[model samples]
Target: MEDGTPSLLDDKKRTSKIARLSLLSLFNRFGFALNSIALPLFALAIGQDEAFYGVMVAAAGYVQAIALFPAGTLSDRKGRGAAILFGGIVNGACLFYLPFVTDSLMIIIVYALTGVGSGFTRTSLDSLIADHTKKGNERTKSYGITIAVATLAASTGPFLAGFIIDPVAFPLAADPLFRYAILFYIMGSFRLAAGIFGFFTERWLHDNPDITPAIVEEAEEEPDDSQELNGNSRDDLITAILFGTSQAMMGISSGMVVPFLIPWIYAAFNPDPIILGSVPAVANLTLASGTLFVGLQSERVGKIKMIFLLYLLTPLLTIGMVYIPIFLVMVGFYVIRMAVANMARPASNSLFMGEISSERRARSLALTRVMWTFPRQTGTLLTSYLLSIGIMGGIVNFGRFFFPIAFMLYPVCVIPMYLAVRRNKRIVEQRRQQRELTDSVEVP
Candidate 1:
């Protein structure tokens, strides 16, 4: 088939699927942002400390990591669409129940359930996208577009939630708990809609003749053991572990900012929720814009090089956050940081998908997610306790201290990432050489 020619699915059908996927991303992110905006405040409202909030979030992360691999395995065996739809429904149900529960333990239970749903939906959705696209550029575009849409939705969600929950503006709407509850209710409805849409969409691979079930089955059965044979000597399993550990570390770094940022801003400057929402909104918008650039230029830039460059810049951005004394400056620094951070995401994802075999892709992706979430939650829990002890009493002083520590750790983190990338590159080259040798022998 020509590159520009439409598949048997037709242009309209393909477009529809993409649209549904985009909407699904949007809704999922909306729910995520809503929870991010509300959860810490919910803990405060229930008279729980910051440490409790951290623990709650961490529990959710742990659950998500645990569920991700199993969910991916199921999606591989069953259908991706069914797995995603089922997960979405479960997520919606959890959100619906979230508002009604006041007990901390109950809240933790609900969050953990949501994490399970998250694992199912996200893992399946990514795999489905991979299954649909044959071209590398197209896959990158798809991921970039999906992330951009999610960022836009996330930006909107927090702003709306903040406006609704702001005590001064709404006066009567000052009930933070009720406002948060309503936001979750809306998010649940969004999830239900996405789930229904997912249920009706046609199978991604079925429409393409080039992607025969027999071919996929064959690929799955013949596990690629080239990595094991090559003197390259580095195990992908070990690399994956290192990658996951780095992700956990990054998550911890992020946790230091997220759960505390709003409350810190509130305590120091007493800004309204709307103003508080602006910080993340700005960050999300920047991220979206950066992703759009990546989508347009990805084919030209070469994925790995672009990702490496972006990754190197991230720690500097994090350190920059420490120097800004004013709130607006901090927001600006954060926006820049997020933009740089997101610029690397699509490339990293493409690298990951390209490196792994079809059968192992799901588990590999799950492993990455586990690393990302688990460490973040652990970091959040620890940071909350530290913050509770009045460690970060002053903004400038705290930033000066923590930023340098984070900066010092950045190079250490980069070493693992660099090694992994090199190892993957070598593996790809080895695979290419082996394929050529086999093809040459077969031609005789």
Candidate 2:
């Protein structure tokens, strides 16, 4: 494990590093989840229609996506710690101001600005993990731990927000609308904590002479064609783009479901906050569980195959959501959908990381994030606007129209996931053959 290659297994000291990284992952994800859960409700509080809210949220995605590649390049050059810290502070500061802004345009602007921060943090965070851990099982475990922590934070954030943001809880409160702002503030605080934590734990290339350009140049100059296919290829890039696009499209399709689900469920039966929280809670738990499972198996299953299986399951799980009527049944479907979606996360991440050179990992991941976020934001903007127009005033009817669209588009997303896996497999096989040939010649 000490030989040049990275190891996923952690010694006692490395375990500490994983812990710190996991904490950072948790805090960062907490900030993201806090906004994701509250943003729509915040817009609703301000009398903004669905479309307006969608546009606001989607704008963030577009900005984040657009900024990702640049942010990655910067991270690769400047160091992950500094990048994350800067983004965190900026993101936190923006969150603190979110409560004060009332105008829709101003809110959109703020969201977009936050996107820049998001791009900075998100692009570098995973790469930081990759840098710390040696490639193989250790890498997989580290990523899995990160995902589990993030999912745990994401699962908890919304449930907590649901209680905090409930208007009834704030009957005598100074400004009920400000409750969402408070949540944002908490999220910001978490981001700040993550930034500080990251500052201490991240290993900067500038500080480590071993990882300097001299090493990179040597690695690049080595005429090892066998390892050529080990990294990202043009085909892998295309597949990544395709997969990213599909994920974004799915985001658009699924965007309406969350906003409408509560209302629809309430209309079908009596409104129960417990049920609302429970449904999503179950889903998130499933996702977290699946992430944990995948993380553990990341090496054994291989990253590419795991992603392919996960993508294939998405349409089936999501379509199941449309048919389930009972709240519990709906929760069941949600669980399946979430687990399947999340199971692919580690694999997808590994594939992205595996495909690119270490220097470009941040950029590649950022690009993937951009693709996923942009489409979802576009969808959110479109759907929210339509909902504001009362296109389908009823929740059930809206689900009927939207869920199917999401289901149909899911297969398209799978195409990229499949292609990436297949391309990776081809590359791996090619490399194996070349290695055998070289071994034979050397033996002679």
Candidate 3:
């Protein structure tokens, strides 16, 4: 393979690279999962309310949303491995500082800073994944495998963190604060482990010049009469914009209640930490299963159809959550909902990634991510305020007014992306037929 091109790597070498990167992803995801359950509880323990928790969550997203745009461009211009290393170090440092922050404001500030590092790591890693795998089915499968591996860590981290920190459950230490501190330390260690591993990985790549992928040049391409947009016939600008828009709407819908789910469950059901922790742990496990299934089967089933069917099932399932009052029933619904809703990720990622040119992939991905995060975070902030003011009042025994609105938006938001994908599919089939005709005429 040429230095700038990634199409020629032998299968074994590519698998090795993906494996190494996925290992790094495991460490990061575990750390994040620990904090995901812990952060809301920590806020309450420090005398802050759900509103403050919302602020903390939204602050991180706001920072990440701002940083991802440039991070993507940097990944394209500078390289993926280096960006991952830099992000891991920065993220680790912030997590290490988390235990020291007792004040609500400081906690939010430090956690928000973690977002900057996450943007760098996430953008670079996603682009690198695309770079390593062949496009279409293989790429989707790789994403599924990588994501499943990471989510496995996510499933376990919450269970462990909850067990260790729950004073009523474990009583490991006299002071509850001590347990929280210990949990944060463990989270920091995981992030630093990723940083250290990434550092060595980058060093090895630096030493091996032939294996390092050259930075893809993002120079403008000459206009092609046959192509409708950019240099590629299938790379439709409208499709990209529509996909991004749909994602942003989905984010907004989720942001309204997703961040507050654990807290809501705790306050409503009064479950112990173990049970509360199980929610996310189970959800992550189910998500891993769903992503893996979608990754493997998406090509066979058709990506758009699979995405549409899965998404359609989610809103119906979510509406059931609004009516159900039993904790076990709710958990079951939630588990199924998580599996069905998130299973669309790999297929959607493949669809979006396959449509963009390699040179501009990072930027386009960053744009779509920003669109999703900014709106979601904005919605989170709004929801927090509404919850605080009792504006998002309870709709029933179990549901908040925000809950149904969030799930209902799922199918609606997916519509534009569905249309866009169908259009692109049509364009691709037409081009394939045109090429066949050209080949037949030339042969004669």
Candidate 4:
């Protein structure tokens, strides 16, 4: 469009695009970090109790699960930019509405809307990145760096909310419900700002009409996406299903942790906003570090192998999560363990990317979410009820109830993942060796 042909960027547009995407992540995550502490406290304050908190969390996941695959498929057919832009708007509106919510039921509805927004937004971004890069090391590094930057930006969310909640800044800090509402207001404003970033980023992407976006100003024939008579398509499908199943196994444990961890910490330790914010700050910091490590190590270590090895650490961390006696130690354990378990996530995603064909990439990723949905949906509720009941003979909060049960359940998710990785790895190796042998024979 600038000179009668599609120029992906002309220095200025490139800078504009990068700046917007970076700021978009920073502001959006700042809002989410506020919710990390506020949502649970708000539920309890409204007299809904922990069980309702479970339902609130479940409601979001349910909506996300339902919306994910369809949204991905739609984006592939339509355009990734529209999906991302719409998602940011929906999330911003939902967060803005959070400040006004008083009734528990209304809160649950907002949570669901945000969940739908998350599904569309996440799928679009993942697909967008894949569209921009070919299947290889470039894709791996791009995914890793993107996640690392966002997580690092989000690390400040808890601290910002915590500082605002400090009695030094706000008078309502003493009243739990009012304080939570104020935090929601601040975070919502940031989310609204994030919507602006998404809008600009979407507009700029219109200039570069490649695999990343379905909206091309030029009229061209679309590639046939059919799988009939395509051998590689069948192989890719098999690998995709296998990879998705394994990722779901890993997701179940993490899903259970997010909704209830702060509440658990409050019940077991203290309710200070400083404590609530600080813990997540540490977790996000470590996640950023872990993602960076994967990006740096991708070429040195095989992505699939690194992913498998990193996941092997899950059971150990989850086990330690339940048995740790001191709150500080438990928090430290949570940070390290989470980092260890997720350090290779970018690599795992890259592995998935390498296996699937371009046409089905987004939906394939969504299918992975679907695989994890039921287990996580059930796990969150089950853990919440179990936590409510306490342990045998009235002893739950001590050390043997909420987390240990999840530790015991961790294997159920990862075992299938291990098998899937092993099978996929073997297949890949066989293909490589056969190709090398054929190449040698052809040369002679």
Candidate 5:
């Protein structure tokens, strides 16, 4: 009620709905993993270089950046379910077209279109999840369970895709390109299924009388407009901005490194397909574990504190991951760093979303994503350009240039969020003391 949504599902309804959404998201993530594992390799197979791959990824980000705000507004106005349904279909279709296209321009265009679908699905899904849960630990728990389940599938997808596509392993098709195409088709199928299931799931939730709009009216006889009219709206906006900026900084750091990891491995080590695939598989599995574990700890430790700690740890890990000469040791650092860096997300998201009104939640989330994606994409482009020109020496030097910058930025980014949390706590304490004084006066 405090978050400003029209309805809140009871515990029973909330549990059931969250379960359904998690399953749907699980399917989507699995499909996404398959493509993600294959796409860069597929590009490399097609004789394109790192710069081209960066351009390809950036194109999608660019389109996604453009679509995010409008998609958020659309979800706010129309319905979260509709946005999910539409996004699923559009995204699946775009992905389906990928294996067939050999032309570089067409590939970029189609891949870019997938961003539109992603924009709609991601914004709507987050909003829908937030809408269902109350602020604080409950929301964090929901996100943790959902991400854990979804990422469980994601962890497996890479291994499976690699097995099927690996010329040394299964080698279903004589042509490597054919193997990739087959993987793409399978990926598209799962994505399409996720969208269709999401639509039905939304319908099922709506049919629950307890979750209906009519029941929401009965639950709250009169709405309080004061929450919005008070200065809290200004504070909420400011908090949202700070949160977005922090994420953007994180994004810029990650964009340079995360997306390029597999590509970097391929270029530097020229490892086997299964080896290449295992990197992400191991990372995702750890990520799922880390996300769930950190989420559970977030409430106990305090959301802000948990976030700051994680932020501080990642920079140190990044440096180690960058410098360690041993391949497996470096990967160990990479995996741990990936887990450590991302562990704060559930806590971070819950804290920010808890403070924002439901009416403004989607837009605020979208704006935050835009801030993250734009800079992130720019970092990607910068890295690619540097790689293309041989400016950073080579791929090995990428970590040296980007990771240190990221290391510096990570600690700085947390400052704004820390300030916001302090301000919020202070205001809440003031309000509580004022209420106690008012009660004492009334009693006298």
Candidate 6:
């Protein structure tokens, strides 16, 4: 494998696997989009309070945290296929039950189970994709394509909900509970489709095995990453820790935004389903477009530089998300915000995973997720409390006040990433200089 242009589409096996994985990602996210809308709204309608809705939203994080480490351990030993299949099944089953669960606790419990399943499915799907692709450009492109498929598919979900059942209809609209439940049923169907895709993708990949071609640039002087003693470089640990912290902070604020954002917009502006649906849909489509460009350019633009710029812009977008007064303007800002924040994800992931030795990749990934999980739950709780108590005055608009604080938190979170990117660059330069010195001495 000399240094030449590598094409993922050139190989039949790789092409087939990537296609299946893309489809799997597409279905998985489509359900996720629907849940974003239906689950929180349903909880709010049933409980008639923001507190319970927050708690219910938090329940998924709890289960995901609990399942995270185990799922990783399982995937490393038994392979990712079974884990993903199991997760899809569990996720589908839980969503299917959501429509039937009328009580708050039951709603929380079902969502918790779905989160647990997601822990298994999402991590494995991620690791499995990483396993299949070549390092550097291929991996970045694969991730971007996979994410684009999923994002674009998910983008349709809100639109689908908007189209199917009008937010303001006759008898069904009269009862918020019944109106949202219909959407729940529709989301469950999407989950079922996702489960089927997961199973099929797994089986399809296994039935056809192909050794992924190694790239010239990625070859190592060493035998295997697993041979290292406990794959724990201080630099890697620091990177992971900083990355995880940034993710957690972002997650907390994001947790506050995603589940409750639509409901908040509806109350504040009273937008129709078409309007409501368009917001998230456009946001995701924007993300998909940005992701494709990021993938294409990240190889040349430099991943860290791209990520740093994106992180820098995040706080401004968060501010925009909070204070934009007009309905359509807010939606426009949200799309840009989502795109800016998420477009760098694959590149950031490439940087992080490149640091960890293969042996500890799963464990490191699992550990990092813990930092994100706790913060997300806490954010939801805090936001719900603010909403419940009317801390800033208006019942529906208290989030407006909290938005500043959350947006401000973005700066704090990004500090570590800034440090990591700079530090990693310094270390790489030091390594290059040392290598040159060794080569010079040897030549003499």
Give the top-scoring candidate (lDDT): 5
| TM-score of model number 2 | 0.82
Q: How does candidate 4 fare on TM-score?
A: 0.80
**What TM-score does structure 3 among the candidates reach?**
0.86
Candidate 2 global lDDT: 0.68
- Of the two candidates 3 and 5, the one with more favorable TM-score, higher being better, is 5
Candidate 6, number of clashes:
0
The sequence of per-residue lDDT tens digits that candidate 4 reaches over residues 380-421 is 776666656753432225234545445444445445545655
Model 2 ranges off by over 4 Å: 1-10, 167-174, 204-275, 424-444
Candidate 6 local lDDT, residue 362? 66
> Can you write out model 6's per-residue Cα lDDT over 269-358, one digit (the tens) per residue?
877666677788888899998987887679789886787688678767766766888777888777897798788878876666665556
At residue 139, give the lDDT of candidate 6. Answer: 75
Query: Which ten contiguous residues of candidate 4 have the minimum total lDDT?
Result: 222-231
Ranking by TM-score: 5, 3, 6, 1, 2, 4
Most TM-score-accurate candidate: 5
Backbone collisions counted per model: 0, 11, 0, 0, 0, 0
What C-alpha lDDT values do all the predictions have? 0.68, 0.68, 0.77, 0.67, 0.78, 0.71
lDDT of 5: 0.78
Candidates 2 and 3: which is better by TM-score? Answer: 3
User: Residue 261 of model 6: what lDDT?
Assistant: 68
For candidate 3, lDDT tens digit of each residue in 1-444?
377355545344555666776787787778788876788887777887888989998999999988897788778888877777778788888877888877768888999988888888787777776765555566788778888899976798888778876877888688877778888888877876776776566555446445322222235453222232232624645666778899898999889877876777777787888778888899899899888899889988988889888878877887776567899998988888878988788888877787777778888888888889998999899878877776645313324555776777887777888777677767766776887899999995
Tens digits of per-residue lDDT for model 5 on 1-444?
A: 666453333645655776787898797788788755687788888998877888888888889889998988888888787888888888889877888898989988998888888888888888877776656566787777788889877898888777877888985589988888788788777877777877777678667746421111123332232122133567777877888888788778878877777777676677788887887789889999889887677888988778878878887887787777778997898788878887777888777777677888888889888998998899888888888988767777776567656666776788778877677766766776887899999995
Model 3: runs farther than 4 Å from truth?
1-15, 199-238, 392-398, 422-444
